[model samples]
Target: MNLASISTKQYVEQRDKGYWIAGTRISLDSVVYSFLNGESPEGIVQNFPLLSLEQVYGVITFYLANQELVDAYLKEDEAEFRRLQEACREKNPLLYQKLKAAQAQKNSAA
Candidate 1:
């Protein structure tokens, strides 16, 4: 067996400004979050039909092998998301308020 092939096989790549499943645009964060939330590999595959069972398992293995680095990256990504959300809310207070009210109504109905 080519140790190089086994050692160099990468499940994720950083490009287009984010980490994605090597050749697909599906973000690693999506799989990680779903897995963290108790979703099975099959469930994750269903949620992201573009991904295969192998790809999901590969990404999960990658995450497990690099949990500390991946966790820090996740934290940074979440902070950026919150910052962008706040900026959007400030830019469109009316739309934000309308969405918030709609969400509340939906929740009450549920």
Candidate 2:
């Protein structure tokens, strides 16, 4: 198949929460984040064993080809994540505090 034909068959899907790779639970954001963090495609595949190198490369290509749009989407997703985290904390202040304390203790121990 030609390049155009192959690309037209999207490897990513848009969901209510965020973009995911078409056939897997892996998030497109995670792939892009790893790539932006200077991980090689091989490294990304290593980190996410479920993903093939081709899928990782496709995600990177999509991000590179649409950097502005993808960045905006990522920013919005992050904001939503922070909002949900705050809401969860508000809903369970004591639990959140305890979890934070435990995490801090673990970090100190490490």
Candidate 3:
């Protein structure tokens, strides 16, 4: 199937609406987020081996099919990611700071 277009039916779920990302261990939000961030479908599949090519295509299709839904999912996921990042920072002060600083420096240079 073409990876460029997908549908909601392809956006499978498990446990609950938000329990699994597109019917795989990967969450719907995370997959969409990575794809928006320029991750290739194959890259996403590799990162999430639990996902079949169809699942990846499905999520990609879902996002393409439902812009509003995908956007909302991405927003919620951003907050969740920030929460985790902050928690990690608190848990590992030095490492967190080092990585943050490095990332910031890299961005600034760019």
Candidate 4:
């Protein structure tokens, strides 16, 4: 088989936004996070039914083989998420403030 086709057979694909398993919308970040949080490969498949056990195991193998690189990418992704969240909050300060107040009130009632 050709190299490109062979590579596509891998569990993961590098997408425009981030890495995802082939044939699914599930992100590598989601899988890695669950795995790191003590979820087994089987458990991951249970959590994301779109994925197969074989795919989950392959992703775990990939993560173990490239831990440092994947960790760095995850960190950058988190930073970008935080930046976007902050921007959204800034754009809707009143809405956020009201939400925060409601949450606080709910917490206090609890």
Please name the candidate that would achieve the greatest TM-score relative to the true structure: 1
**Model 2 TM-score?**
0.86
lDDT of 4 by residue, 19-109 (tens): 9987788899999999999999999999999899999999999999999989999999999999998998999999999999999999999
Best by lDDT: 1
Q: What local distance difference test score does each model get?
A: 0.94, 0.90, 0.76, 0.92
How much RMSD separates candidate 2 from the native structure? Answer: 2.4
Which of the two, 2 or 3, has more lDDT? 2
lDDT of 1: 0.94
Q: Taking the tens digit of each residue's C-alpha lDDT, what string does model 2 give over 15-71? A: 876799888999998999999999999999999999988889888888888899899
Per-candidate count of clashing residue pairs (backbone under 3 Å) = 0, 0, 4, 0
Q: For residue 62, what is the lDDT in candidate 3? A: 67
Deviation from truth (RMSD, Å), model 4: 3.8
* Model 1 agreement with the true structure over 1-110: per-residue lDDT tens digits: 87766755678999966788999889999999999999999999999999999999999999999999999999999999999999999999999999999999999999
Could you tell me how far off, in angstroms, the CA of residue 55 lies in candidate 1 after the best superposition?
A: 0.9
Off by over 4 Å in 1: 1-8
TM-score of each: 0.89, 0.86, 0.55, 0.84
Residue 74, model 3: lDDT of: 63
